[model samples]
Target: MLLMTSIIITISTIILLKNKKSDLLDLKSEIKSISWPDKKEVNQSMLTVTLIIISASLIIWLIDSTLTFLISKII
Candidate 1:
């Protein structure tokens, strides 16, 4: 079983490398050309996202709590 699995994996890898060599190279070059964000920019974006998430969560919680309270009072 192990030998058969290894053989299958080897055949798949060979086919992939042969057929996708150009695609892989293109991807590598594209990755290299990407302008990654700097630490300050990333940090600022992260902070903004976190604040938005927290605000949304608080709003949802408030709405849920109000609904629950109203429903309980009715019951």
Candidate 2:
């Protein structure tokens, strides 16, 4: 069983190495073609995300507090 597993692994490895070389080259070219964000754009995006997250958290907290107060009053 061990020998069969080793042989299967070896064959698969050889096949993958041969076939994936071209795919890797294509990926490298595609990455080079991409328009990466500049530092200013990245900072602006991060700030926007942080503001949205804080706003959502505050809204959720307000709702939770309101429900808790109403529940406490009813009890």
Candidate 3:
């Protein structure tokens, strides 16, 4: 999974950089507007990440536990 994810990210980044190379490089002033996420938005994103991590961990633990229990019973 990690290898697959890395390959996908690398490919996408390369594609993006290739596309952006055609644009004129300007270092004097900011051309694009940067909007930072508000506190509420940041908090929401953090909450989402935390929830996903916790859920995935729980699922993995449950699966391992079930397999171990089943194996012990069979033995």
Per-candidate count of clashing residue pairs (backbone under 3 Å): 0, 0, 0
Tens digits of per-residue lDDT, candidate 3, 1-75, equal: 999999999999999997676554542234555568999999999999999999999999999999999999999
lDDT of 3 at 42: 100
Number of clashing residue pairs, candidate 1? 0
Ranking by lDDT: 2, 1, 3
Worst 10 residues of 1 by lDDT: 16-25
Write one digit per residue (lDDT tens) for candidate 1, span 1-75: 999999999999999998799888899999999999999999999999999999999999999999999999999
* Each candidate: RMSD: 5.6, 3.7, 15.4
* Model 3 bad stretches (over 4 Å): 1-32
TM-scores for candidates 1 onward, in order: 0.71, 0.74, 0.56
Estimate the lDDT of model 1.
Answer: 0.97
Say which candidate scores most in lDDT: 2
Kindly list the per-residue Cα lDDT of model 2 for residues 1-75, writing each as its tens digit.
Answer: 999999999999999998899899999999999999999999999999999999999999999999999999999
lDDT of each: 0.97, 0.98, 0.87
Q: After superposition, how far is residue 39 of candidate 3 from its true place, in Å?
A: 0.4
